[model samples]
Target: MTSLYDADGQALACTVIQAGPCVVTQLRTEEKDGYKAVQLAYGEKKEKNTTKPMLGHFKAAGTTPKRKVVEFKYFAREFELGKTLTIGDVFAEGDFVDVVGKVKGRGFQGVVKRHGFGGVGGQTHGQHNRARHPGSIGACSFPSRVFKGLRMAGRMGGNRVTIQNLRVLKIIPEQNLLVISGSVPGAKESFVIIEK
Candidate 1:
């Protein structure tokens, strides 16, 4: 969960992602659903997470019950209803994977912490007020324009991110665990996708 190791075994920092033995709840085809994809369901929560429409979705698939449905675009294979997917089939140990998840939200923050700006050069330079301020909105008299897409501080994190090509270390099929070599986003037990 913290570091990565190559095949020869050297430590590197990366993220770990645990894929699933997801259930094939829905199958989409180009002719019918206008796309080729498979809808997979993972995790099982209490009835609160299962709505009436979702209950019908599970019932139609004949699955034992689950939350968290995600669709994959592996258009080559055809998945039928109620088919159970396993980690061993989709990925193996030593395979490279991409981990996608929403990062933790760090509410509102200032420019110093958010954007990595070096504040105010030095305290003795009579620059106390500009210290953490974004500084310089526009030109004085030239074009006189504040360009868009500037780096300023506001809300941070809680966004979807995809970390690519993380090597898989251990695949424990018995415990349904994946000891990937590196760090994954979100806290422990947070849902994430591991894709090839």
Candidate 2:
């Protein structure tokens, strides 16, 4: 994330993203695959690291093995196999887009950090070492067992998250980079899908 100055000299915080130079690896149609979607491959990978079948797949597309391949449904644009797509081809400045990515994993976490619980409130009235405890999990014997889907201390983050309607602050077509307003999901160098 970085700050940029506008025409009015106001600093705006934004995140710089390396958008893409994605290649069209495969196309799915209603008749052939019972769906309409485009499979795009991005990022380069060594051929040895890729499986034999995937190697054949990339061979069919006339491209090298890619680190990431994703299918986007309802893609209206017509593209030929082995075509490369850059950021400028799909988006313009000021366009609103949705970014989908996985959030950073926090591993095991307490309720206070995970669910924003108040943490027993200030250690008052003989409350010792119970600040971050999830109070009162269940009743004495009414339900008998712990309920399903209870919000407690457990694994946090590392989930697929989408940030919608983020304004496109700027576009650097030459470098295939995009500057978007506000923060996006995932850690640095993580792959994300940007949708119109």
Q: Write candidate 1's Cα lDDT for 1-196 as tens digits.
A: 4665566888777554456778999988899989888899998767676788888889899986686888889756677899888877677878887889889989998888999987656667666667777776666677777567777889999999988887777787865667766677777778887777
**Candidate 2 lDDT by residue in tens digits, 14-65:** 9999989999999999999999999999999998899999999999999999
What's each prediction's TM-score?
0.87, 0.95
How many backbone collisions does model 1 have? 7
How many clashes does each candidate structure show, in the order listed? 7, 0
